[model samples]
Structures are given as C-alpha cells and as structure tokens.
Target chain A: MKTSDFRFDPSQVRTGYSHSTIFKEDGFGMNYCSSCGVRVLTQVPEGDHLPRQVCPSCHTIHYSNPKILVGAIPVWERKILLCRRAIAPREGYWTMPSGFMENGETLQMGAARETFEESLARVTIEDLMSVINIAAHNQVHILFRAQMDSPEHGVTLESSEVRFFEEAEIPWADLAFRTVTQALTHFVEDRQRGQRTLHLVDLETTRP
Target chain B: MKTSDFRFDPSQVRTGYSHSTIFKEDGFGMNYCSSCGVRVLTQVPEGDHLPRQVCPSCHTIHYSNPKILVGAIPVWERKILLCRRAIAPREGYWTMPSGFMENGETLQMGAARETFEESLARVTIEDLMSVINIAAHNQVHILFRAQMDSPEHGVTLESSEVRFFEEAEIPWADLAFRTVTQALTHFVEDRQRGQRTLHLVDLETTRP
Candidate 1:
C-alpha cells in the first residue's frame, strides 16, 4: 500500500489508527505484539497498498517506531543482574531485568519493578543507562543504571536462571533483545568515558 | 471485563485488548493506520489478552508498540522556533516544530524533516536534550537540543505563524505539549548550568 494512505491526522498520535494490509505474500504468520499481546490482523482493504495493524479496542494505529522499554542496570561489585527468559520468541535468552512501561507507572517504577520481579535483586535505580529504541519492535527501551541492595539474592520470577555476569562475560549473542545488547554497549562505552563509578556498597545490605 | 481483557504486554510495552466498550461509550473515536486507512478491529475469539491489532485485508497480523518522537530545540541567536498550532486537541496553543517519524527514516532525519516541515527553518541537530515518555499519546518524545542553520530563516509549515521569540518573550500560558514547556525549562536550566558554548555556523545561503 502507498505510505501516504497510512498517514493520519497528527492529533491521532494520542489514539492509534486501524491498519490495512502492507506485507508481501508469504508474510502470513502469528504477528505478535511484543508489548501488547494482540494477534496482528493482516487483511488489506480495498484502495490500500499495504497491510497495517490497528488496535481493535483503542482504535490506535501501529507503526515501526522505537518504543521505550525500561530495564535495570543493577550492578553489585563488578557484576550485574541478568535473567534467562522462561518464555518464547527467545526463550532462555539472557536479558537485564526489564519490561515495557505500564499505565500509571513512571519509567523509574517500571525499571524497579522489572528488576525486582525478574532477579529478586532489589535495587535503587540510579541514573539512566541509555535510551535505545528497537524500531523493529517499536520500543524505546530505557536501561536504568541501578545498584543492587544485596548481591546474593536469588532469582524470583519465571527466569530459567539468574547470574552475575562480569562485564567481560556478557553473552552478546544470546541476549534476549537488541536492547540489552545496546545497553551493554552503552555500559562499556560509558565505562571507557570513565563513568563507571561504583559507590562500593557491600552486598550484605543490598537485598530486599 | 477482567483487567486481563484489556491486557498490555510488559514484555512488548504497548497497549492492546482495551475494552471495545470504552471507545464506543466514551466516544474517544478511532485511529486508522497511515499505510492503509482502515478502522483497527476490536473483537477477538475469546479470553485472549495478547494486545493485538488486526487488518481487514491481506489478513496479516502486525504487532506494534509505542513510538518514539524526536524534536529539535531550534535556537537562533538568542531566540527559538515556537509556533501556535492552527489545529485541534490544542488549537491556537503554542508548541515546538515537531512531528512523528515516517517509515525508513532515522530519528535525526525525522527531527530535521519535522522541524523544517512545521517551521520552515533548516537546522543542524546537535546535542541531545532530556527524553520524556509521552504516555498521553503512547509515544516517547525525544527533544534534541538543536541549532538553526540561519538565524534569519523563518518558518514554513502548519503554524499559525512563526517567530524567533526570546526567552523573555515566551508565552508560557499559551504553550502546547508538556514537552515544549519542559524543553524550555531545560533550556533555561542549561544556561544556569553555566555551559554557554553555543556553536556558531555561518549560513552559506538562505531558504524561503
């Protein structure tokens, strides 16, 4: 479909629009909304050149824009909290304790909640790690650089496993999402810029 | 309906499965996809909270999340690019020269395109400004602190009119999006931070 057909009123930015078909043939598959678990509808309407997805309830439209996905950059000593997913798309892949933004929750709260839920490692979020947008998923994932309250806490959520991987040990290939890779990249870049100032908190008093 | 019926995937970070009744009863109106203008569907088979939007044609399901919008902090000499919208939601209110990212465009490209499209002034995007998640529209709007290519170039887009208003001349009450106000706040804050190194570039030529 023509790109212009998909464009809508700027005011519609608040509420998304319905989509027409845009994918080429053989694109049929379970279109998963990473943030919203809706099944993508791919039917192209008449007078449309492309297939698009639209929110059934909210009537908001979807675009391949970057979404703000928040995560924890919790560090204990020289290690950080990482979770192995117990779910699909990339089951068993490692990721920072992170998730998407929720209604009524600030970015800070989202990061904190995800960190605690995934790692059981309570942390007081520090400054931002970096804002990286994964446009393919329409997410602007925010990795908040936090410090853990304790270093010895075990896993809590549906994580297959949890571990404290040192900077050199980060598994770049097995990262759950590109955001983690981006976050780690930023972490290293920032460190090179001399920004890795650990407050040197003891692991004993760090657990919730 | 259960809150799960209006489920949002924290994993993906976008809204899906909102109650269809919410829109029908509240008259919030519907948003359509920009690629193919169609009303996004709402009903699902049953008990599914996957947060998906559907297309009528091509029958391809496409998943979408929140979008990240970037803006330019147009500064000319001691003035900036500000406008009064001639449209709705905030009719006649003031806002920055900003728009959404088109497909296949970079964040910086979108910013530059939007700034000139809305204000008619070309600029060289510079440093990053503070990023904010505009939850009201399910967008993460990033406002970059930018520099005008020519101080004398005027605005050319949907603005009621354009002007390089000085800080003291800013019409605070008439300001539009919270991001605009916030950007202005940061501008003042940066000045107070005592970092007054405004990069100067000679305007080789001018544009109408």
Candidate 2:
C-alpha cells in the first residue's frame, strides 16, 4: 500500500496501527512540536500520570487519544450496503463506509457525511448499531443502522463500486475492516431476532 | 471556583463550556508552532476540509477533535454513587464519579480508573449505560453501569464526599453537570423497568 492510495480513496476502513495504535503502544512519543515547530520533549507533564509531548518552548502539552471513526451500516429491507475499496491495505475488498472523523462534528454528522462521501447514498442514519474499539488503529468505530432515503445512490469517487448484499451474499472473508464484519454479523443476528440493540465490542483480540 | 480547585478535584462532572467548549465555538486557530515556537498559519492542508493549525517551520498539521469523558455509575442496592465537587462551574454540587479520559487506555479502562481515582472504590464496571454527546461542551460522555465490589468506599482526594443516592435522594437541582442527571435518571427509570438497555442519548436539549 502506498500513501497515495488514501488521497483519492480516503473512505477506506482503518486497519492496523498508523497514528493512534503506535501512539498508544508507547507514549506516542513523536518529536517536533506542531505548536512551535520545535523538537518536543516527551515527559510526564507535571502532576499528570501519562507522559505527553510537552513543548519546552511554549509549554503546550500535546495529548494523543483514540480517534473516532463513524460510518453507516446501510440497510434497505434485508440487503446491507457495501463499498468496494480502490485504496491499499484492502484494495478490491468490500466493507462498510467509514473514515477518520474530522474535528467539530457530532458522531451522527460524521457518519452521514462519510456515507454520502463513500457511496453517494442518501441514508436516513438511525440508531447506533455498534461501537467497536479497534486497538490496532487507536480508533473507535461507531456504526449506525440506516436505510436508503429513496434508492441507493451512485458509486462515489472514493469507492470502486457500491452495492448491497443480504446475509448469504456478504463477502465475509473479503471484508476490508474487522469492525465491519463484526457489525454486519451483529446486524444479521439482531435481524433474526427482530431487534436492533446497541452493541459495544472491543476488537483487541480479533486482530491477526 | 478557583483554578487550584481542579488540581485536587479533577473528577467533577462537566457543566458549562470549559476549555473544550470555547475551543469548539471558534476555529481554535491558535498558532505558535509547538516545535519552533513560531506562529502557525491557518490554511487548508492538502486534501483537507477545514483549515488547520499548520506549522510552516516544521510543516506539521495540528488536528484537534472533541474529547471523550468516561465514568461508571456505582450502584449498591438501589442507591447510586455521587461525588461532591470542589471544582469550578458547579463547585460543591453533586455528580457522578467521572473525569476526562486519558490517553493510552480503553474506554472501559478509563471509566474504571476514574471510578477508582474519584471514589477510591473498586467497581465491577459492566456494559455502557449511556453515551451522550454534549454539543455545548464539545465532548462525549460514556457512562457505565457498575456494582460496588463490596460496599461503597470512602471519599477520594478528588471529591469532597462520596456517597450513594436513591431515586428520591438524588439532588436534582444541585447536580454539578446536566449529563450526570440524565444518566442517573435513565438508571432510575431502567431499574424501575427491570432492565438496563444501552442508551445512546444526545443531551443537546439539556444545554443552556
């Protein structure tokens, strides 16, 4: 996979440690202060338990926390929407539409935006389906249960194609992100029981 | 009400806009490169939506997002745990044992740690009770349902007092944060219903 892949196809699912996972492993002790553009000193900030990237020049402490990834598990009747990736890490693989949440947006807003951007689908994003923490990417994946506004929209520029699949039609082995698979599985089981309860799952042990 | 109050009592419930609220209200265009101590220019980085604090000296983009706050509702019998705050915005008011989530920890880990730190109590934190988006504060509050290991512990250094409150005993008017009251109310209602389903609430209406 190359960095260029993410530029054109930024809607791909978050995988292993890129920024968040690495930072969580250690102090995320990255050098160079974005504040003062100087080499930052990594140390336990006074009276704080965790060591942060403290700027000696301006005294601004840099904190690293898990990023939130919001998306929609689009469903029209029994069919669930899927996006085929054109990016690396899982190019040609299928998964739910999701990406790193930007600043200054609610989880729902982010989910709606990502869905529209990835699949060009106008979805009525509904209740929270699952909140899965992907430790590998230092990301919290929050997927919403949604239905098509009218009909499924066109294929977005971010994906190779957009389609829907029922339980038996899902590409389980060819899914892009692990959280997508877990969410889809939950949807299937919950649909079988005729319910949509919120699921909170930790994907720490699900990694290869 | 003083800043020093936060030092020893950092576990107070989130009330009005503090640091995060103000930052979110604006673009948080504060510059001054963390690396070189130079002023960072506000401009759209490559393939980005909103403008970010980009340090020209070090060429680093500073991205900021709303933070997560996690805590647990400590229950013993029918009473829920409450902590007296010594911090500003609602000093001396009662609230749940919650705090700003720290880096390098899972949501559950942060909730457990905050519970232990604020009340010195050992709780078996269980499923997520409520995940609220406090838009005014630009924060997400994730509350869990937990049972006291034995009995409720003593007052923590971060609290003026630690005690339990039944439905009628809850100090509604004296609550430190709006989000706290909502979570506790849910627990009370859910307890009455003989079930505790996960609640995904957006407490935007509760804001001033």
Fraction of native contacts (fnat) of each candidate:
0.09, 0.18
Candidate 2 residue spans exceeding 4 A from truth: A1-38, A205-208, B1-30, B33-38, B57-59, B205-208
DockQ of predictions, in order shown: 0.10, 0.17
DockQ score for candidate 2? 0.17
- Residue B41 lDDT in model 1? 62
lDDT of 2 at A142: 85
Model 1 has a DockQ score of 0.10
- Candidate 1 lDDT over residue span A1-208, tens digit each: 0011111123332122223211321222325332344445544334322344544544434434334457777789868678889877688899888876543344665677677667777777666556553333333456667778778556554588989888888899899865577677777667778874211110111111
Candidate 2 chain B, poorest ten consecutive residues by summed lDDT:
B1-10
TM-score of every model versus the real structure: 0.63, 0.82
Question: What would you estimate as the lDDT of candidate 2?
Answer: 0.70
